[model samples]
Target chain A: MIEVKHLTKKYGDLVAVNDLNFKVEKGHIWGLLGPNAAGKTTTMRILTGYLPATDGQATVADFDVFEQPNDVKKVIGYLPESVPLYPEMTVTEYLGFVADIKQIPKAKKREAIEKTIVTSGLRSVRGRLIKNISRGYRQRVGIAQALIHDPRILILDEPTTGLDPAQIIEIRELIKSLKGERTIILSTHILAEVTQTCDGAVIINDGFLMASGSLEELTASFAVKKAGVHIRLRSASAEASALFKNMAGVKDVRPQDGGFTIEWSPGADLRDDVTRLVVEKDMGLLEMRPLGMNIEDLYLKIISGGMPQ
Target chain B: MKNIWAVFKKETKCYFTSPVAYVVIFVFLILTGFFFHSLISWFNTQSMQMAQNPYYMQQININQMVYSPLFHNISIILLLVIPLLTMRLLAEEKKIKTDELLYTSPISVLQIILGKYLAALFVLFVMLALTGVYSLFTFAYGNPELPAILCGYLGLFLMGAAFMGVGLFFSSLTENQIVAAVLTFGSLLLFWILNWAAFSAGAFWKDTLNYLSFFQHFDDLTRGILDTSDLVYYASFAFFGLFLTHSVLQSRRWR
Candidate 1:
């Protein structure tokens, strides 16, 4: 539903987003994962048509952001990083105003506002002035305003930034429930969040797209060879570690306190064979699990290694 | 057009629901009231002291022409007050990052500018309406020409609209409302003070500068002459200011 190609945003001498290209298919949440100043926010802004790209093309629902902005805007609901809201307005009034500006019909305006209030979980505090509400509620109100017109796409920038843990969970759950119905581009530094909430991720560093794929795919890209089984047992010596290393599919084994941790060469399946060997040796199979790489490790590898553009 | 109306209504609602509009109106009324009372006192003193001296004295010094000074004085007050009222029209939205919401909405930049401009103009219009009581008092004291009084009020309102247009342009340039207000005031003062240069600059330059002076086009109406050029000048000034404000906002995305 969204396509960004060769998009670059430059602020004077500094490049905020550099030649980034990506496409978000319909009905999937794409987490834009990046560190601070990673150009994630700049990419989101360009996609929302709030900022013009220095050079490139971006579109939403087949409407070019640069040339057909109103069409693109109509299809997308964007919650900016700062969660801009008029402090003096009550929650209900603010949402109503949003509906009006979004051009919801007069007949549907009230219903749209009510639906957004419910969807955003802001019924009780609808009458409270936004300035008096907590940060969490302010965020919910921002989300509500964006969803008031029920746009097909939701581009949320750090929607959970300042909220407390419970509030974060609540917002995350709300976004999760919104999946399958709308295309979402969620940007945040929280890696675990992308794992739980988004189907795919696009990682960028220093204004460049370092990697982009499913969480597992991106994580696996950093692995030189897939991690093997790490076993913890009652009593085992270096001889036993060597024996395990000599087993099929096992490339190297390191002796631990009571067991040996063995790694497998790439494209090798060692699960059943290692279990058979441990069973035959009569060694306690205590614990054996693959040490899957995480986004942190992959992120550091790409950034510190200075991955090519 | 529907988008423009939508923006207009929302902007108007914002002004009413916020204390900014009330504070501006209250201050405007208080200052205009003080000026009106002073003018009334001056007229009363003149009338009492010259009770028996009737040799066309009233016609010679028609300071009793209450509506003219009231409108003229309101325009002067606008120079100070319009900036405060308009400083946050677009700037605060950018500062708080709400400009994204508006800019990404379906409304055009022209719609947003006109919406904000009309909202500020509405507050000024309401202030003008509230001061109608002073005109009633004018009628109570001495009969003034209704056409002249109306012409003067129209001139003042049009001039205030022009000033507000300029304030909106300055507001679009920065995110800080305070900075916008200060810059708008400085620019308005420069235009107001341009007429002073006429004394030193001789007739040719004087007239040239006079055309540029905001208050110059306003003079004919304040003197009870409704010149079409003066009317066109104020209208064009307002149009130009709003157009520039729209362009500034549109260019901001590229910057």
Candidate 2:
């Protein structure tokens, strides 16, 4: 539902977002993965029509961001990084005001506010002032305001930044529940948030798009060829290491305190070979397992420009 | 239009929810009341002297002595107080970052400006309406010219609106409320004394200073003259201020 083409935003000599290109498909949750100052917020602002792109184009829901900003704004709900809110207003009152500004019909405004309050799990604090609420509840109110209009696209900048562990989990669950219902583009530096809640991710660094794909595709495409195996053997000696290193597909073997670690090439299942070698050499094999790459490893590899395949 | 109304209602509600509106209105009414009481005492003394001496035939116009000065003092008070009403309009939003919500909304810049401008004008209208009690008192015991009183109020309202527009523009220029308030006060004071330069300057400079003086235009209205030029001046002054405010808001997108 969103397409950004060579988007560039410059402030004098500083480029906030440089030649960034990405597209988000409809009904998919895309996580914008980047560290602080990675141009994620700038890119989101341009997509939402909040800031003019210095040299590029973006469109949302088929409306050009520069040419038809009003139309684009109508279909996209944005929650800025700061969670802009009127502290003096109650949850219901604030949502009501947002609904009014969004031009929901007068007859349906009340219903819309109620639905958003419930959706964001803000019904309990509906009557309390926003300033008096907890940070988690405040974030929920921010989300509620964005959802009041039921826009097709939701752009959230760091939706779970200041929350505690449980609050973060609650927010992640809320966002995960929203998957497949709307096109969601959320930016976060937390690798787990992307893995837990998003179906796809766009990794960026220094205002450059490093990688973009589904979670599995990103991990698989950025996977390293070498795999490490940890083995505990009764007979941990030089002969054992030599025997393991001499086996087919085994690249290196290093002895440790209790056993040794073996490195091998990809697409080679050396578990049976190592098992038979250990049995034949009379090296009692206590344990042997293959280490797989997690999202954090994939993210680090992509950010460090070390993608193997 | 609906967007304007929504913003207007929200802004007006915000004014009442905070202490700024009540404090400004209360202080304004108290100051205007004091000025009205003193003016009425002076008028009473002048009338008493005239009643004692039958040979004194120069009649004093009650509108001139009472209502004219009353409106004039209120206008000055508004000059000092309108900034307080308008300082938080746009500046506070910028400080708190709520301008993101406003700019990202589908509403146009014109609607936001008009909504805020009208909300401030409505607060001033309510305060002006409260001052009407003084006029009712004059009608009970004295004969004041109704047309002259109406004209005085018209001038005060228009001048207040013009000042509010300028204050709103300054509010848009900064995120600091104190800076916005002080700048607005300074600008209004400069306009208040624009004609002061006429005494030291030559003909061309003197006429230019006098023509630019807001007080000069207000003087003719206080005397019950409904000059179209003065009306157009106030209207255009407000328009110019709002236009600049719109430009400032639009320029923010580029930044």
Candidate 3:
């Protein structure tokens, strides 16, 4: 539903987003994952046609962001990072204003506002001024404003940033409930949010694409590139460590608390040989463990080792 | 057109629901009423003296002595209070960041500007309409020239709109409402006093300053002369201000 290619946004001497490329499929919630100042907000703004990119192309629902901004704006709903809302306006009134601006027909404007109020879980505070509502409800009001026109695409920037833990969970559930028929690009620094809510993610750092794939694919790709295999020993000795290090097809060994962790070259298996040597020498090998790449592991590996080849 | 209406409705609703509209209107009426009472008292005092002489009595027409000067006073009051009406129009939206919602919506920038400009203009209309009671009082108590009073109203309304347009541009230029108000007041004051600078200038510079001065264009209308030049000047001035606001918003998006 959305595609951004070579998107670079520069502000005079500073480049906010550089050579960024990512795609989001229909009906999938994709996280734009990055740390602070990663150009996630800038990228989202560009996609929503709220900001013009310095160079490169971005499209929403087949409309060029640069050439056909209004068309792009029509297809995508944007929740800016601050969750901008008119605090003086009540929830329903705000939604009605959004519906009007989004060009919802007068006949269906009320219906659209009603549906958005429900979808954003803003029913209870619908009559209250946004300023009087809690941050959670205000956030809901912001989302409701974005969803008022029922656009197919939603670009939400840090939708859960300022909420309490319980409120965060509520927002996450709300996002999860918006699962079907909406292509969502939710940006966040929170890694766990992606694991729980996003089907996949385009990970960027310092305006550069670090990795972009489903969870399994991202970890799997990193696993292949970093090392093919790792063996863990509950108890081991210096002799055992030397044996694993010199063993054919073994890459390196890292000794930890009463244990030794071993990694082997890509497409190699030295587990059998290492096991036989430890048994013959009667070295203390309490247990054997295989290292599986999780998200945290992949992220650390990328940060420590630089970009994957 | 629909988008403009949508924006207009939202803005007008904001004004009505808040105390700002009532407070501004109330304050404006009090000031104008004070000015009217004092000017009319002076006019009455002068009329008694002029009553003894035919030529002086003819020189002391109500339109010249009261309504015309009242129109000028109202325009001056408008110059002060219009910033209050317009400072928050775009500046408050930018300060609160609700402008993001408007910018990302399907509505064009031109529509947003027009809708907001018209909303302030509507409040100006309300302010002017309430002052009509003063004219009715004159009609009931004295035989003032009705056409001149009506023409003076037209002049004040158009000039107030022109003030709103300038105020809207300044509002668009800043996110601070105070800054917008100050900038608008300063700019309007500069334009209002341009005619003073024209006094010492040669023919070419004097004519340029006179044409550029906002009150200069308002002069004909207050004289009960509905010249197309005055109408076009006010209309174009309002349009130009909105046009400048549009340009500011569009360029700000790129940044």
**What lDDT score goes with residue A103 in model 2?**
86
Q: A1-309 in candidate 3: lDDT tens per residue?
A: 899999999989888989998888889999998888888999998898888899999988889999999898898889999877877788888888888899999999888988887788888888998889988888888788778888899999999988999989999998888879989989998889999999998888777788898877787777645443344454466777787788777777888767677777766767788779777877656767666668876665554446662
lDDT of each: 0.84, 0.90, 0.86
Steric clash pairs (candidate 3): none
- What tens digits encode model 2's per-residue C-alpha lDDT throughout A88-140? 99988899889988889999998899888888999789999999999999999
For all the models shown, what interface RMSD does each have? 1.5, 1.0, 1.2
The residue pairs found clashing in candidate 2 are: none
> Individual DockQ of the candidates?
0.67, 0.76, 0.65
lDDT of 1 by residue, B50-84 (tens): 76678645553443345567667888898999999
Candidate 1 regions off by >4 Å? A216-223, A232-250, A255-260, A264-287, A292-296, A306-309, B57-65
Q: Alpha carbon lDDT of residue B36, candidate 3?
A: 92
Chain B TM-scores across candidates:
0.93, 0.97, 0.96
**What lDDT would candidate 3 get against the real structure?**
0.86
Q: For model 3, how does the per-residue alpha-carbon lDDT over B1-255 read when each residue is reduced to its tens digit?
A: 999998998899999898989999999999999999998999989999999999897787888888888888889889999999999999999898888888899989999998998889899999999999898878887898888778889989988888899999999999999999999999999998899999999999999999989879888788788888888888898889988999999997667
Interface RMSD of 1: 1.5
